[model samples]
Target: MSWSDSFLVLVLALAVEAAFGYPGRLYTRIGHPVTWIGRLIKALDRSFNRETWSAGRRRAAGLLALLVLLAVTGLAARSMEFALAATGPIGFCAIAVLASSLLAQRSLHEHVAAVSTGLREHGIEGGRAAVSMIVGRNPQSLDEAGVSRAAIESLAENFSDGIVAPAFWLGIGGPTGAVLYKAANTADSMIGHRTPRHEAFGWAAARFDDLVNLPASRLTALLIVIAAALNRNASPRAALRALFRDARHHRSPNAGWPEAAMAGALGLRLAGPRIYGNVRVEDRWMGDGRADATAQDIDRALVLYRTACTLLFGLALTIPMLIWLIAS
Candidate 1:
């Protein structure tokens, strides 16, 4: 399929997700496959000791595993495509449904929205619980401001990692690309920490994830800036400036873009001192806005997220239609 056609598929998947939202608990149950995948990854991780394994060997092994996984996923998708071609419209619909399940647009939004609602209804405790699931941080001691910061940061960062990055890969390489990207991301999240146990063993997963996310992260920032402009609260110029100026402050090169853009657009600072597994790292802050964020800021960030998603979906759909029209 052409890039345009793949882009259309991504748009369709996003539309279906936005319109109906995910099935929530049912979707969570359906995530068993991913859970199993994670478990398999963990088992592999345990087999490779960080201190005992050389970085080059670990990278080689990770790449081999990735290739095998990609081949398997590709074969499965191609088989499904062939089966569906013979089965007519029902088969095609099934393919779409299956593909949509891999995209996390609805799930991402739902989780962030829950955080906002929790803060609104049940105060800091509720917000803490919601934030804890989405972020790696010490939530027990967070005040309202900290909770809002964590939730908004997660929403922005995950927009790139969880949603946009997957869509971009799916557009370029179909279901195989999407699945591989998710597996890489999942593996990184599972063992990509800088701690002694993961530093060497997870080097490949983390580095591969960074490479995969490079383009998508920048694209996410652009989309957010455009969305902010549409909303009239955030200037695209300022967003771009903030993205360039502050993105380097974060530890991860890719994550900084979206987070800094969101912070600039919303006029809030993010990424300060936070404990990771009891280690406190004095992280540089992004943006030049309020240090004390409120629940209202989280709501605004959600608005930006929704707008960006809509804008991105529209762009994806339009590209394919334009191409088809020109060809005709």
Candidate 2:
């Protein structure tokens, strides 16, 4: 497809996702594209990530599996794009709908908002239950502040993973690029860890996922900072400062960018040491701000998230025209 077609598809996708998120009925009926991607990864993982194999062998097999994953995911997405394009301009709308289904801006907002509501309605326990849906950390171990911080951190990090990254790839590479990213991300989540079982086998998936997310993660931090600057009460300078100071200390090369930006924007400390299941991870804090994060702070983060998403969407629209202008 042409660059104009790709950009238009992305803009439509962003608009559709911002307006009407993928419906629960649709999910219940067919599950999500990620779920479909997850199934494929699992199948490949089961076949290739064999425990009986030597670590080196497993690693090599894992790399092979990733190649297979990329090929299949790209082909599937291309077929869908082609089928949609067959419908002409109406096909572009169909492509937009398909692409939008892969993004999670509205859904992420709703999920994080639920954490706030749960905290307000039923205290820490309610918040814990709500947050457990989105975060991998054990909810039973969390206090009110922990729950709130987890919700906000997840919000900031996922804004890049779930929305900006996909949109960035789509704007540049179309629906196929978006889906391929989703596939990579899914593999990382499922297998990308330092755990012995997955350490060798998941290395390629983890690294590939991180590589793709690199630009979007930093871009997301910038978007958040710009959004905070636009807001009267938020501190864009703090966000920028926090990015330089704290983002480097984060274990994940990308996650810290948005997390620090968020922490600074909201004037709350996030990341730091946290327990996932029974394991206590000794991570550096993202911001030099108050640690007493609350549901109210979560609500504030959601507002910032919305603003950042809008700004990123606007950026997506501008990029193609700018490229065209320069080319012309």
Candidate 3:
């Protein structure tokens, strides 16, 4: 396909995902790209992560394992890129479908909506269960407010990681960029824990994920700040302040940006100390807003999130056309 045609496909893929998401029938049968990448990451983790190895050796093994992962996934994605170019219109459509599956726009909305609905209908127990599926914290330990806060935090963070990051890469380099990102992200999720088993072996995946996600995560925050400018009880200035102050204090270099931005945008506190399983993490909170968050706050956050996504879509559509015009 031509450059303009390729960009059009990239934009279409984003639109398709934002509108329809991945099809359930396809998910039930062949599964999704993230799932496929997850399986490979799991296999590599199983094979390379041996407790018998020394920490230094395990770290090196981790680096080696990551390279192998990149090589395998990169080849598959590049082959797809070539095949798409060779097959004309059908392949273009096929690649757009494949790229759409790599994004999480539709599923994110559904998942966050489920959490809010569970809270409204099933009370604390339901909210906790729904929130637990998305967050790392111990669900049973959370109160109604905590559950709501957790759900909102997950929405903001994953909005950046799962949605914006993939789309940014896809827009830049199409399917190969999108697939490579998914592989790195999957590896990070699978092995990026600080536990004894993964602390050394998962180092590369964690760091690489951080590096690749750096730009998108910040852009996600900026988008949220812009969205906050258009809403009430939400301050764009506060969002910017929180993003600069609290974003640096969070555990993950990337996650804190959007999470802090969303927190400030919604006027709610997030990411404070929480219990994950038996462990209590003394993490700093994001935002200088309300401490007692509610389901209503979640609704507000979702509004801001949806608006940010729309603005992002507009920018994605416009920037390329501008470039095309300039070049011509």
Candidate 4:
């Protein structure tokens, strides 16, 4: 497909996802496919128990899995394209719907909203439980402020990973690109850790995921800052400063951008010492003004997220129209 065609597909897919979201409860009841994918990876991980496999074999397996996922997604998209050519616009709409199902805009919003609701009703414990699913950190010991910070941070970070990054890839490479990026991200989530078992084996997944997210994460931060300014809660100056100052401090190069921007926009601090699988890492704080974060701050962060998403949808549609005009 041409670049313009891919851009059109992305806009349509984003519209579909933004409108309908992933059928989470239904997908969950039917068995979450992503969870099943993780389980499959876990099962395969057992084969490396020998502790003596050549590095070459591990690398080969990771590459092979990535290639298979990419190929399968490509075939699916090509099949849809063929059907569209033979059938009609309905086939194209079906392809768009199928592509959008793979993105998780609605799912991300629902998870974050659940965290906010839990905080409102059940306090810290409830909030922690809701946030824990999205974050890798141990939530059992988090206080109210910590829980609130986690929720806001997850909202900022996932805006890039779950929404913007996938959309960016889809714009560039169509459904095939979206699927490949999702597969890499899913693999990284499943195995990307500092644990002895996966430290070496997951290097490729982690690095590739970072590469995929690099640009989208920065753009997500910019969009969030713009959204905050539009909401009258934050200035562009603070947003830009926070984005540049703290974005590199986070372990993941891409995640820090949006998280830092959210922190600055909300005038709250995020990221610090946290336990992960019994290991403790002293993370640097992201914002400058305040250490105390509240449930209200979480709500503000959500507003920023919604605003950014809306702005993104507008931009996606406008960019295509502009390109078409220039070409004409």
Candidate 5:
């Protein structure tokens, strides 16, 4: 298929996902792509990662394991594409449906919004329960405001990692590119950590995930800023300012950009010191706004998020048409 066709597929995929997220019945029956990738990563970790091995050896083994996972994932995606190419329009639709599974637009929104609902209806305990589903932080450590901030933080970071990153790769290399990214990202989430067990073995997955996420993170931040401009409740100037001023301070190289933009746009402070498990991590606050975020703030963040997603769809639709026009 042509490059334009591939981009069109991406646009269609995004629309499809936004309209109807992965069916609960379908997931119960076959599980999801990320789960499948997670299983592979788990096996590799068990087989290759050993306490007896030196850090250097474990690192090499981790890199090899990652290569194997990507190779397997890429081959399968390419084979599917090649087979689907023969069926014309039906195949295009099928490819789009499959590709849509890789994105988390609907799921991310639902999960984050649930936190707000929980906070409103059930209070602090309810908010903690809901936010725990999305974030890895210790739920008990959070009060109502912390719960709200955690939900917003998860929404901003996942906006870049879950939605934009996959779509960006899909536009670039079709299903194969997106699938490979999902695999790498899944690996990083499963194994990439600074803990004693994974610090050495997960180094490759961690680094590679960071490398792939670099472009999408920046793009997501810009998208958030533009979305803020369109949102009356949000401040575009502040969003842009926070993007420049505070994004660099967050621990993760890629996560800070979108988080800072979202924080500034909504006039809320985020990140700062937080507990993950028993560990209290000390980090710089993202925005210079109020740290006492409420459920209302989460609603505002959702508005900005939905608008940014719309902007992404517009770009996806426009860019391909522009390329075709230039070629013609």
Candidate 6:
């Protein structure tokens, strides 16, 4: 299919996911796409990631495993796309529904907002419980401000990673690209770590995920800045400033952009030092704002997130029209 058609698919998928996220019942009946991908990664790791092998051999095995994963995922997605290609509107809608599963728009909002609700209703204990669900850090280490900041950080990072990246790939490479990206991302999450076992073995998955996520990260940051511009309470100028000043300093190459923008737009400091499980990671701060974030701040961040999502949908719609106009 043409790029225009792919973008149209993206637009419809965004709308469907935003309106009704993958239903819980549907997930119960048949596992979600990511879960399916995760199972495959688990199988590959069990079969190939042998500890006795030299690091070089293991790394080679890792690359080979990643290639196999991508090949299988791409072939399956392309086959489905081909099967649906001749069905006209019905096929388009069906593809869009399948594609919608890849996005996290509605679920991200719900999860982040749950933190605020938990904080407001049940105090620190409630806040920790809710925030723990979304963040990898030790929830017990956080105070009220820390909990709030963690939630906001997760919202910003996930906005780019979970929502924008998938949609961006969908627009560019159709179903094959989107699913293939998801497979790589899942592999990274499962094995792309600095741990002795994963460090060498997961190099390819980690590096490739970082590369594919580059454009979407910047685009997500820009969308957040624009959303800030539209919100009276948000500071678009601060968001833009943070993008230039602090994004690169962040530990992650891509996560910094949206995190910094969200921090500046919301006037909060985020992603400095944190304890993940037992390890203390001393990362650079993202925004030059208040560190004592509150539940109200989380509410504000959700506003920006919602606005950014809307802007993303708008962007998806606009691209197809532009492509059509240029072609004409």
Question: What lDDT is obtained when candidate 6 is compared to the true structure?
Answer: 0.94
Tell me the lDDT of model 1 at 198: 70
Residue 241's lDDT within candidate 1 is 79
- The TM-score measured for candidate 1 stands at 0.91
Q: What TM-score does structure 2 among the candidates reach? A: 0.98
Error of 2 at 268 (Å): 1.1
The residue-by-residue lDDT of candidate 1 on 96-154, one tens digit each, is 56567667777788888888889999988999998888988888868999999988999
Per-residue lDDT for 316 in model 4?
A: 78
For all candidates in order, the CA lDDT equals 0.80, 0.92, 0.88, 0.79, 0.96, 0.94
Candidate 2: clashing pairs of residues = none
Q: Could you tell me every candidate's TM-score relative to the true structure?
A: 0.91, 0.98, 0.97, 0.91, 0.99, 0.99
Determine the C-alpha RMSD for candidate 4 after optimal superposition of all C-alphas.
2.3
Candidate 2 residue lDDT tens string, 59-128:
9998999999999999989998898899888888889999999899899999999999999999988999
lDDT tens readout by residue for model 5, 1-328: 6678879989999999999999999999999999999998999999999989999999999999999999999999999998997898899899999999999999999999999999999999999999999999999999999999999999999999999999999999889999999999999999999989999999999999999999999999999999999989999999888889999999999999999999999999999999999999999999999999999999999999999999999999998999899999
Tens-place lDDT per residue, model 6, 1-328, is 8999999999999999999999999999999999999998989999989999999999999999999999988999999998997898999899999999999999999999999999999999999999999998999999999999999999999998899999999999997889998998899889999998899889888998899889999999999999999999999999999889999999889999999999999988999999999999999999999999999999999999998999999999999999999999
The alpha-carbon RMSD values of the candidates against the true structure, listed in the order shown, are 2.2, 1.1, 1.4, 2.3, 0.7, 0.8
Model 6 misplacement above 4 A: none
lDDT of model 1 at position 56? 74
Q: What is the TM-score (0 to 1) of candidate 3?
A: 0.97
| Tens digit per residue, CA lDDT, model 3, 1-328 | 3456556667888899988888899889998888888888889889988999999999999999999998999999989888886898898888887788888888888888888899899998889888988998899889988998998999999999998898888877677888898999999999888999999999999999999999999899999999999888689999998999999999989999999999888888999999999899999999998878888888888888889888888877887798799888
List where candidate 5 sits over 4 angstroms from the true fold.
none
Candidate 4 wrong stretches, greater than 4 Å: 28-50, 54-57, 84-86
Ranking by lDDT: 5, 6, 2, 3, 1, 4
Q: Which is the leading candidate under lDDT? A: 5
- Residue 166's lDDT within candidate 3 is 88
